[model samples]
Target: MPVFLTIETTCDETAAALVTDQLEVLASVVASQDKLHQQYGGVVPEIASRAHVERILPVIHETVQRAGISLADIDAVAVAYTPGLAGSLLVGVTAAKTLALALGKPLIGINHLQAHIYACRMAAGRDVFPCVGLVISGGHTCLYRCRDPLDFELLGTTIDDAAGEAFDKVAVMLGLPYPGGPSIQKAAEKGDPHKYAFPRALLDDPNTLDFSFSGLKTAVRYAITGPGRHDPSQVKLSDQEVADLAASFQEAVVDCLVGKSFRALEITGFHRLCVGGGVAANKRLRTRLEEEAARRNVDLVIAPLKLCTDNAVMGAIAVEKWKAGVFDDLYLDAEPGVVRRSSALIHG
Candidate 1:
């Protein structure tokens, strides 16, 4: 089997993995910048990019060492090139291009969002196509009608803030820790999800599949500090108040995600649903999805918790392209922003 080295520096995580032609992961390593950006309440693009530059090489070396193989054994190189922080993507793409040039091997460019959905296939240990793929993360919240591992048509997307981004901002409002998903989930466990009736924007609009979390985020803000110009830092919230707010806010986000996911399935008539990304690790969201899927008789595949966060293991999607003989030239560049497909292209 040909060995491939895959790099994933799309955001705050510096990651690399060694995989075989058969999708077997020999080794995977990720260097997280959570602590570095924790104080800022969210990721700072410049800081994330700089950290990736510093850690990408070491991460690749560690992955290779763990795999018990040297660079000579690798047959190809792959790196995520699109839908990411510009500087972060450039670091990985530059490194992969350099390695491919030096080793005389083909280079493959992976789409970061597509790779997230592919994580479900990795977890299933089987092909999971012709499904509705929902990717919820700090930077993305969109749905795709996935015809195969490589073919994805955009179904719907967020009009404002992504779900995970809202979580981070709300966490800051409630004095919770950064990387808000996990922190908010933990805090929400002890509170009533119905304590406050947070708005679920666009949920009532069955005609469209778009999501809107900005209003919900603002509602949480007003709940914390009345709809006035008061600093959130000065507002003292008791432990119970924080927990209740977290619970209510989380419920609102989950409602929007679940409602939209099922709507996509209904629209596409796909029996299977695959979900991945960082916020997919939320316990409440996972349980709710499981319940809903079971009730609707939908085949649901969620990436394992370990695979839910940004990591190179999911970049194994590159293997599919490699097998199809799809390769990228050295001119491959990073696309910092997401490019959405027109609604007219959506398949029923």
Candidate 2:
């Protein structure tokens, strides 16, 4: 099987990976920017770009060495070219293009969202067709009707803040910590999700599969403070209060995902479900979704917690493009405001 050297610098992480056509990861390395972005409360594009420039080369070197191959053995250079910050995207694109040219190999540009779906398949070692892929991360919360590995149609998406973003914002409002998902999940382990009845937005939209987490996030904020969306200083949360809020917020997000995902399965007659993105790492979600899938006799494949977030091994998503002869040229440039535009909306 042909092997590709892949790179992903769409956001705060700088990653380089080597994957075979069989989806066997030879070596994958990620230089995370979590610490740098922690103080800022979120990913800052300028900082992300500079960090990528600094980390890309070293990460690539390490991955290739770990893979036990030199640039000469790689068949192509693959990179995420869409749906990412321009500065960060540029770093990956330029590096990929340069490698492709220097190595005299084909250049492949990939869609970041599509890669997330493909990741489920790679981790599961089976087709994720006829399923729904719920991508919940700081940057995105989209429901896709994945007809095939490469062919997907967007069924719904976030109209405002994403689920992961909601967690981050709520974390800040609660004075919890940065990178809200983990912190919230950790605290949620001790809280009661049913203790609070937070709202789930756009649950009844007649013609849209769109989601809105801004309201839920606001709800979390208001619960802790007297008034205002985010007045953490107004009220003090005992240890119990923090856990309860985290649990409640996590439950709200999970319920919304479960409702929407099951509907996608029922409507499309696709019993298999694929969950990806950072928030997919939530322990509650993994258990609940699996239970739901089992109850309905449907197959639900959730990636390992490690694969749930943005990492390089998942970059093997390019294997399909490589096999399909879908290659790019050296003229590729990066776009900071890359949005993973929906493929299409499918009813059935």
Question: TM per model?
Answer: 0.98, 0.95
Over 12-62, each residue of candidate 1 has an lDDT whose tens digit, in order, gives 999999999888999999999999999999999999999998898899999
- Quick one: best TM-score, which candidate? 1
* Segments of candidate 2 deviating more than 4 angstroms: 228-230, 336-348
Q: Which candidate is the best by lDDT?
A: 1
Instruction: Tell me the tens digit of each residue's lDDT in model 2 across 1-348.
Output: 799898999888899999989888899999999999899788888999999999999999999999888989999899998787889999999999999999899998887877887778888887678678888888888888877767777788888898888888988876777899999999999999999899988775556677888888778777887454445756778999999988999999988888788777776778888988999999899889988998999988887888788887777878888777787888877754434436455454
